[model samples]
Target: MEHSGKNKTNGFLLMLTLLSVIAVVAAPFVWDRFMEGQTGMIALIVVEVLLVIFIIASSHSLWKNSGSGEWKLKSDKKGMRVYTLKNPGETWLKIKIIGRLKARLASILTLMRNPDAADDVGMFDSYYIDGWDPDKDGVDPKLVYYTFKQKLFPPFKHREFVVKSEFSQDPVTKEMKFNFVAAPDKLPFNKRYHRVTEMHNRWKYTPLENGEVEYEFIYDAVDPGGNFPYALANWLIPAMLPFAFAKMPKILDKEKYRNAKMDYVQEVGEPAEAMA
Candidate 1:
């Protein structure tokens, strides 16, 4: 539980780092677009220098977490670094309950992936608004598709992708794996410029000794999108990592909470629903 809180804090820090970087990078562009003629070249140079300083300061402040936990996240200028951690003490009991939780979890994942899914959670500030998913496929077992119309600044752009997906659980190892590969289709944007062109997403849940479970999530892509916003977007997209990683712990917590309540009811020899 203590570790969970620390992991949450790390996630928040990563988000702050990304937001700070975005602000740092976008300010000069925004200023040039709005006040280009008004501001002299010298003034623009000064602003650019100040922007560099701000970026340095903000990035330093946001990524300076020194917490020890089962959750580890590491990112660098090139891209997200490979890090792995496991949540120990997760039992594979209650098959029916676990199955329900998995289904609900998949639904939640669909909501997260589809930026136009009403945005009830408000996960992204600027996201797809139009007919991104005309097929109405929520979360398919064989294939996953997405067509994105995203607006970060003045203009809105479209992004489309299809993934060949597989979801399976191993009874022997008690590991559940979800893997996907980008389809070989002509993308809306250039393959060299787009961020998600050659995308491959791998998600796994492996139960360890002592009733613990280790989660491994790997997201691989050619490019995230075009250079301007997509460059920053390459960093921003992974900010949602902590949120995704935290969900399973939460689901397990719910199961534990429910079982504890049921245990108390059994101890008292009373019907739980009737009591309510």
Candidate 2:
């Protein structure tokens, strides 16, 4: 189903490109034949200008969907490096962040289980679990449902996401992973904000030999729904991610997270102390 969606998007983009080329080539002849006098000339100029803008925006969107671009370094701050990539035939931009945290897998998992605790980080205007499927042992549930309300700058309205996330561990690498996607139907819609229903994201944690967990985040695609321009949103997202991540080191320093331990997680060595 995902492949089919990608094919449809690519086809639509290709048709749009062909149509744009035809319009550009035909505009001069149209103006020469039907246009007359200053009024006609002004109308022609206006039409051409609008067409050019449309073409530019479409071209930019096409390039991002090409999926051949390299990971562009966007930001490096507070021990994390954020990179952005445009995957082929994807509407939303993809983001990857690589960093190390002075915590164990269990600590991070505990954080994931209690996402609302991180609200103090100020990354989102509001975030909390709306629902979940509890584990039999009453520990970490395999699936969690949550929502995030992000307050955007002026002219852009707030954005919200209702998501369902699942946790897993790689048998060979022992890497802990969380996969999440927008699940709009999981909850009733709210009219106050734009709801994001197109998103696929993942987080992976690999324990390193030096007692630090290598933290990697992959935002495969996140389409902030509504009329917001994709180009502007793409640029703004990367710029804002570093600020959100800068708060992580401190969040992990809290005793609840720093001292957390789980029998299921395989530690690299002795759990390292929180970063100063």
Candidate 3:
């Protein structure tokens, strides 16, 4: 099944590449024949440039393996390290973060299950508009959430996403994984916000002997819709991750999260010992 999916993807990428190349080659001639003016010439050039960028970005994103790339260390601070990979022909960078936090797995899971609770922490208050479980009924392990958020900076348009989130623990290793992926066609389109169509992220937590939880975060890729420049967005996105992660310890220190306990999640040791 997986191989079939890959073959389909490769075929699609090839078709897109051929079409893009043809368009790029034919654009100037079409402009010269049909529209012969300075303004028309400028528009033709813009179209050609955009088409080229699309071809490169799309081809790289679809064909290249997400994990198979040279990653450069971007930041190391407060026990967290951030790495980024700029794949050839891609406009945006893939990011990965590894860190150790003085928190329990249950507490982390609690936060993931209730992301809107972060609004009280003030960090995401302005950005997070709302979120809810689509099923309405309370369920364990798997949940579909629809989240609406606004950009932190200007051109503060809203972005909506529906993602299927799941929590799983390895029986042997005891490591916990929280995975999220874009859920397509789950809800009707809303005119209020731009719907984000592509996103895949995962968080892995490994309990250490001394009670600290070592965590790794992977952001595969995301396409923030609208006219935002991909280059600028890529730069700004990575710059914000460190700040967000540095605040995690403090956020988890809150009474609600610090004292959290879940029956589904197994802690490394006693909460008191871990906190101490």
* Highest-TM-score candidate: 2
Encode model 3's per-residue lDDT on 107-182: one tens digit a residue.
7887776655647434232211133433344644344454544444566566666666777877555688988787
Residue 72 CA error for candidate 3 (Å)?
A: 1.7
Clashing pairs for predicted structure model 2, backbone only? 67-88
Q: Which residue ranges in model 2 land beyond 4 Å of their true spot? A: 1-48, 54-65, 69-79, 123-140, 170-174, 260-276
- Candidate 2 to truth, TM: 0.69
Q: TM per model?
A: 0.37, 0.69, 0.66
Check candidate 1 and list the clashing pairs: 89-212, 90-211, 194-223, 194-225, 195-223, 195-224, 195-225, 196-223
Weakest ten-residue segment in model 3 by summed lDDT: 121-130
Question: lDDT-based ranking, best first?
Answer: 2, 3, 1
Put the candidates in TM-score order, highest first: 2, 3, 1
Would you list the C-alpha lDDT of every candidate in the order shown? 0.45, 0.73, 0.71
Q: lDDT: which is higher, 2 or 3?
A: 2
